[model samples]
Target: MQANSLDDLAAGLARNRIAGLVADLRLDGLHSKAEAAAVQTAALDAYADDFAGYVLVGTSELSRRGLGLSSPIFAPLADRALFGDGWRIHLPQGMIGAQCELAFTLGRAYPERGESIDRHSAADAILACQPAIGLLGRRVRPGTESELAAIADFALHVATVCGPLVEPADKDSLDRAVMTARIDGKTVVTAKAGTILGHPLEALVWLAQKLARHNRQLNAGDVVTIGSCAPILQVLPGQHLTVEFEMIGTASCWFD
Candidate 1:
């Protein structure tokens, strides 16, 4: 599936066996975000039945045409790196960044295929919650200017390190939760929770609806994560990155 250019992705798509691409398409001339999104959708649509669900692709942006759309770029489960604390995650490309987010794993089926969900119902389906730190890497070379360009590169999601699970009712109120990130004993970024679309559960709802647009449903055992309150902090080789959630717990990973 490795190719010299984005055109090569088509050959990979033609196989029709790709659960999905950990794509980082750097094709030129896609001026509008809508067009870029279409490209992402096309990749997903190429393997409609064999789809493994797109991970890490969620954004609500008002287009120039006055439409709010889902930019459908994502990686398959193979790209996920679920790890425990004090684990060494290799950033093969020698470049990586970190974001702290509240992540959830559903215990039971939700929005069951033809069904829709709301924040209240979405929360009901959750099995547990945890502090998660998402890892990001660039694939559109190293000098991409636009955030959207970097996003079109599916390699954005490298791994997600999760903390100990917590029952929904037993977890601390997200609104009062504060977060901090430290690398090698030095603090790098800090943030307050409840700001990713106002709350952690709200982001899950947003994710559910976003997937619904593609005729995709949130199945049981799915992991949905939201945006980070802290700035994307860069990580270096041999450094330790830890994201902590007060009253909940912490998730940490080392880079090599």
Candidate 2:
């Protein structure tokens, strides 16, 4: 993509995000994954001051197959959009979805940019794990945009609600941890944590490697939500959603 086109795409995405409006973006010029990442970075610059970390999407084999993605994609998470459990969330003016996830908060920075990171190393950097609910929405309408366009538009991340942090005695147990999501008091979906890229740590390792390749690294105090454990649940106004993780705890939020 040309520099001007790149800037235009980023600007339009940023505008839609700020206004909480959905748009049909012109993504024909977006050709490569690198270009899509560039557009994402440029668009996120509008909210750089509040940048929290990243939220990885399509981490599960099932999600990858459903989305026709070979690998996972991620988007920046804004601190302003983060909330503690039981918070009342203001719904955006469009269709929205929610996912139950395990989120890790980094205690220290990962190895310097370009340095190798493994599952073990990634595990050592985590301070604690928390049950989380990822609220998802898109700037572009479904079926009208490509994956690249979705990436540039913040990977459909709208907000995140996190439960209390829990320091685990056996981190491996998280791999088999069960997660159940309830919407309006009805069980909607249930799955294991390992469903995310075999193991959640693997997802972290992948994120570290991907960022290092782009000359970035996970830093201290960063909160990264690996991926959804259960199927994405549709969210509606006046609905109450709760996600419980066997290893972590439970996170709940109300849409208003």
Candidate 3:
């Protein structure tokens, strides 16, 4: 093996040892749990998504980490990119579900890899808003998981499905956009554009600050999905769902 590859492997093994030891320690106290979780996140940073220039993340309260993004990002996730083409959507069978969210495709890259930016500046960096579905799945054993570990685990992320793009709107006007979802030809969920932490731009701004802490940044061609506008809905096999960002565009996906 190449020297660097071997070094990475060795480092991953070491990080896993440290995280596993911490995970197995007594964790009833708040500080203990948080400490272990922080270790896990560090291990995750050491190992996952080591190849990509950057990874996508969510900015929603739906995240258990309370960080607005899934635990497992920066990995080779299965998210697919396409327009609002309903035909291309697919979901894992069983308990896998979907969360409708507003995602952005960046046109402008940030100045530094890890530098904080405010909501207004973050908004200026967005190229377009795309209808998005944050695919959800969980595999961690219940008693063994902590919020920090969950974040380290890519926030229990499955994949992200994106639909067609809509031109950016002034924050105030965009706030009025209506959004809805239909499952199996029946409307099951509804919401408004403002539902995402009051505004999707806020999510982006939040992500920027978090990434800056880690010495990371959102760049051009990267996807930044905000939180769901409403509670996530369980999708059944053979179900077709369409999420329309009124006055913006309609994006579709399905369970198979």
Candidate 4:
């Protein structure tokens, strides 16, 4: 698609996103990952001043297969969508789901693009790890759009709620940590931290490398939420959700 047409598509997607309306099938015009990414960038550029960080989605094999995607995709995290623990999120129209995750806050800026960043380097840059819940919603109806269309729709990100930060111990200890999610105090799902691409830090490394490819780098004080550790649970209004990480802390929210 031409750049002007891509921009128009992005604008429509952004409008649908803000209005909580389903997008038309014209989103299928996105032909390649590059075009999808361009649309994503253009759509988010309108809110660049509110940009906080990025969310890496489809990091796990299960989620990737479920989404019919061959690799992971990322979306820009808006500052307005970030909340602290125990926040009450006003329920919006449309289907929504929550995923338990581990979030890393950066202590310092990452090296400029072209520099290599391994797990060790990635680990050293973290300020703390916290339990988090990522709220997801789709702007396009299921089975009605291609994966590229989903990418252009902001990777289904709705909001993120983070709990108290905890300084992490050794990487091995983190790998063994368990994550559990509860809805209305009933256990819904559980998973190990290693389930996130073998280690949560690997998610950081992956983000760093991926960002570098686009000449972008993580800034100090940015919070990056890795992929979900436990299975995503569909949530409803008037319901409460809590996620606890064995070594990290716990985070909760209410939909109302």
**Best to worst by lDDT, what's the order?**
2, 4, 1, 3
Best by lDDT: 2
lDDT score, candidate 1, position 64: 10
Candidate 3's displacement at residue 15, Å, is 18
Q: Report the candidate with higher lDDT, 1 versus 4.
A: 4
lDDT of each candidate versus the true structure: 0.58, 0.82, 0.55, 0.81
- Residue 119 in candidate 4, Cα distance off native in Å: 0.9
Q: Tens-digit lDDT track for model 2 on 5-101?
A: 9988888877877788877777656888889888888888875568778898878876655555577889889888788989998777544578788
* Predicted candidate 3 versus true structure: per-residue lDDT over 1-256, tens digit per residue: 2434334433543343324322232222224333433543444455453322222333334533433333323322323322345665445322336767777777778535443486668777888887877665433333534444444444445556667877765754666777788876678877877756567676677666666766766677776766567666677667777777777676677666
| lDDT, candidate 4, 1-256, per-residue tens | 9998998877876776677676554676778899988988887875345877888777777666655657777887988888999999976555557878888899988854445698888888888888998887777656644678768878878789999998988754687898888889998888888888888889999989888877879999899999786556789989999999997889999998
RMSD values for the candidates in order, in angstroms, are 6.4, 1.8, 7.1, 1.8
- Any runs in candidate 4 off by more than 4 Å, and if so which? 112-115
- Model 2: runs farther than 4 Å from truth? 65-68, 94-96, 112-116
Model 3 / residue 105 / CA error / Å: 0.6
TM-score for each candidate, following the candidate numbering: 0.73, 0.93, 0.69, 0.93
- Which residue segments of model 3 deviate by more than 4 Å? 1-84, 87-90, 93-96, 111-116, 141-145
Itemize residue pairs with steric clashes in candidate 3.
60-68, 70-155, 71-151, 71-154, 71-155, 72-153, 72-154, 72-155, 83-164, 84-164
lDDT of 4: 0.81
